[model samples]
Target: MKAIVLEKAGGPENLHVAEVTKPCIKENEVLVAVKAISLNPADVKPKYEDEMLSMMYGKERPVILGWDIAGTVTEVGSAVTNFEVGDKVFGMVNFPGIGNAYAEFVAAPEAHLAVMPSNVSFTEAAATTLAALTALQILSGKINKGDKVLIQAGSGGVGHFAIQIAKNFGAYVITTASAKNKDFVLSIGADEAIDYHTQKFEEILSDIDFVLDTQGGKVLENSAKVLKNGGAIITTVAPDLPEGVKAAAEKENKTITNILVHSSAEDMNTLKRMLESGAIKPNIYKTFAFEAMADAHREVEKGRTVGKVIVTI
Candidate 1:
C-alpha cells in the first residue's frame, strides 16, 4: 500500500509518499477504502511538538496523520453490525494511534463512524466531521434564542459552522474577519461582521451572551470585555485560561472556559441530519490529490483558508 509517511515531526517538507504495510482490522474496527480526507489544525499540531502522541501511541516510525475521512466500508469486523461492506460512511477517527487516514485505507472503530447523508457529497461530508462537531459541542447547552453571540475567525473552517449553528439556535451572531471576508461571513448567517484589520471587535461589540474564540490569545482576552453579566466564553485554541482573560471576564461577571474537540458517532449523526436538511452547508475552500498531503498541511498552517481543505484518493 502507498501512504504518506513521516519518520519524524518537523515541517511539511518532511512528509513523503512511500510504500507501507496495510493495517489489519481489529475486532471492533472497520476497514475503509478512503475516498477523501480533510485537513484540520489537529493534523498540523502533531507535526510540530507531539510528545504526547509519541508517549501514548508508542509510534516508532512512518506515522500517518489525518482524522476526517469519507469512504466506503470495504471490510467489517466480526463484532460490527450497524454497517456492511458496501456502506458509505463519514466520520473522524481517533487521534494519534488510529490515524492511518492519509492513505488509501483507514481502520476506524465502529463507534467513530456514521452513515453518510445521501445529499452530501463525499468531499463535503469528509470536511464536516471535526469542524462541525467542535462548533456543535461548544455552542451546545449554552446559546439561547435572541442572545448575542460573537464568533472569532468567522471565515475559518470551524468559525463558519459556528456562525450557522448559532443562527439556527436563533442567536444574533456577530463575527470577526478581514474586510475581504466580511460579506462571506455574513452570507453564512452572521448578523454583524467586524473587520479585524480596520476595526477593534471590542470597540464594536458589547453585552454578548456567548463568545466562541477560535483565535486565541489577545483576541480571547479582549472578547471578555463585551460579554454581558453571566455570559460564557469558550475557546479551542489553548488549554489554559490566561490571567488576563479570567480577570476581564471576572470584571464583567462572566465565565471563561476552554475546550478540546472529541469525536463521537452521535455528534456526526446530528451533523449529517443538519446537512441533509439543508440547515447547514459546508464550505470547502480547496481539494488536493492524496499525493499532495504535505501541501495540504502547509496550507492549514497558514491559517487563512476560508473553509476546509480536502485530499482525494
Candidate 2:
C-alpha cells in the first residue's frame, strides 16, 4: 500500500510518499479503502513540531498523520456487526490517537464510523468528519432554541459547521469573519456576521447565550465579554482559559471550557442525516489529489481557507 510517511517532524516537505505495508485490522476494527481524507489544523501541528508528534504518537517513527476519512469497507472485524464488507463509512477514526488515514487502507474501529449518507459524496463526507464532529459535540445539549450563539472564525472549517449546526438547533447564530466572507457566512445560516477585521466583536455584540471559540488568546478573552451571565463559552484552541477571562466568567457566573473533539458513531449518524437532508452543507474550499498532500497542508496553514480543504485518495 502507498502511504504518506513522516520519519521526523519538520515541514510539509517532510511528508513523503512511500510504499508501506498495509495495516491489519483488530477484532473490533474494519479495513477501509480510503477514498478521501480531510485535513484539519490539528493535522498540521504534528508535521512541524517534534513535541506534538511525540505527544500524539509517543515516539512512533514513520508516523501517518490523519484521522478523518471516508471510504468503503473492504473487510470487517470478526466482532463487528453493524458494518458489512462493502459498507460506505465515514468518521474521525481514533481521534486524539493514531488513525493512520493517509494511506490506501485504514483499520478503523467500528464504533468510530457511521454509514456514509447516500446523498453525500466521499469528499464531502470526509470533509465533515473531524470539523463537523467538533461543532456537533461542542453545541449539543449546550444551547437552546432561539438562544443567541456566537461562532468565532466562521469562515474556517469548524466555524462553518458550527454556524449551520447552531442554526439547525434553532439558535440565532452569529459569527465572525473578514468582510469578504461576510456573505459567505450568512449564506450558511449565520443570522449575523461580524466583520472581525473592522469591528471588534465584543464592542457591538452582547448577551450571547453560547460562544464557540475557534481562535484563542485575545479572541477567546474577548468572547467572554459578550456572553450573558449564565451563558457558556467553549474553546477548541486554548488548553487553559486565560486568568482574566476565567475571572470574568467566574464573576459573571458564566462557564468556560476547552473541548477536544472525539469520535462518535452516534454524532456521525446525526451529521449523516443532516448531510442527507441538506440541513448542513460542507463548503469545500478546495480539493487536492492524494499525491498533493503537501499542497493541501500549505493551503490549510495559510489559515484563510473559507471551509474544509480535502485530499481525494
Candidate 3:
C-alpha cells in the first residue's frame, strides 16, 4: 500500500509518499480500500508540533495522519455483521486515536462506519465525516426549533455543517464570516451573516440561545456575550475557558464547555440520511490527488479554506 508517512513533526514538506505494508483488521474491524480522505485542522496540527503528534499517535514515528475516510470495504472482520466486502463505507475512524487513513487502505472499526448513501459521492461522503459529526454531536440535544443559534467561523469546515444542521432543526441560524464569504455562508442556510472583520458579533447579535464556537480565545469570550442568560456555548477549539470568561458565564448563569469530536456510527447514519435527502450539502473548496497530500496540508494551513479540503486516492 502507498501512504504518506510523516518523517518528522515540522511542516508539510515532512509528509512524504512511501510504500508501506497494508494494515490488518481486528475481529471487529474492516479493511477498506480508501477512496477519499478529508483534511481537518487536527490533521494539520500534528504536522508542525511534536506535542500534538505524540498526543495523537504516541511516539509512533513515520505515522500516518488522518481520520476522515470514505472507501469500499475489501474485507470484513469475522464479527462484523453490518458490512460486507463490497459495501461502500465512510466515517471518522478511531478519532482521538490512531486512524492511519492517509493511505490506499485503512483498518476501520465496523462500529465507526456507516454505509455511504447512494446519492453521495466518495469525496462528499469523506468531507462530511469529521466536520459534520462534530456539528451533529454538538447541537443534537442542545438546540430546539425557533431558537437563535450562532455558529462562529461559518465558512470553515465545521462551521459550514453547523449552519445547515441548525437550520434543519428549525433554529434561526446566525453565522460569522469575513465579508467576502458572507454570501457563501448565507447560501448554505445561515439566516444572518455577521462580517467579523467590520462588525462585532456581540454588539449586533443578542439573546442567542446556543453558540457553536469554532474559534477560541477572544472569539469564544465574545460568543459568550451574545448568548441569552442561561444559554449554552460549546467550543471545539478552547479546551479551557479563561478565568474572566468563566466568571462571566457564571455570572450570567450560562454554560460553557469544550468538545472534541468522537467517532459514532449512529450519528454517521443520521448524516447519511441528511446527505441523501439534500438536507445538508458539502461545500468542497478543493480536492487534491493522493500524491499531493503535502499540498493539501498547505492549503488547509492557510486557515482560509471556505469549506472542506479533500484528497482522492
How many angstroms is residue 185 displaced in model 3 relative to the true structure, after the best TM-score fit?
Answer: 1.0
Model 3, position 56, has a per-residue lDDT of 78
The CA lDDT at 280 in model 1 is 88
Supply the global lDDT for candidate 1. Answer: 0.87
Instruction: Encode model 2's per-residue lDDT on 78-174: one tens digit a residue.
Output: 9999999889999999998999999999999999999999998999999999999999999999999999999999999999999999999999999
lDDT at position 1, candidate 2: 98
| Per-prediction TM-score | 0.95, 0.98, 0.98
- Quickly count the clashes in candidate 1: 0
CA RMSD of each candidate after superposition: 1.7, 0.9, 0.9
Clashing pairs in 2: none
The numbered model that scores best in lDDT is: 3
Lowest lDDT 10-mer window, candidate 3?
Answer: 237-246
* TM-score between model 1 and native: 0.95
**Minimal lDDT window, size 10, model 1:** 49-58
lDDT by candidate, in order shown: 0.87, 0.93, 0.94
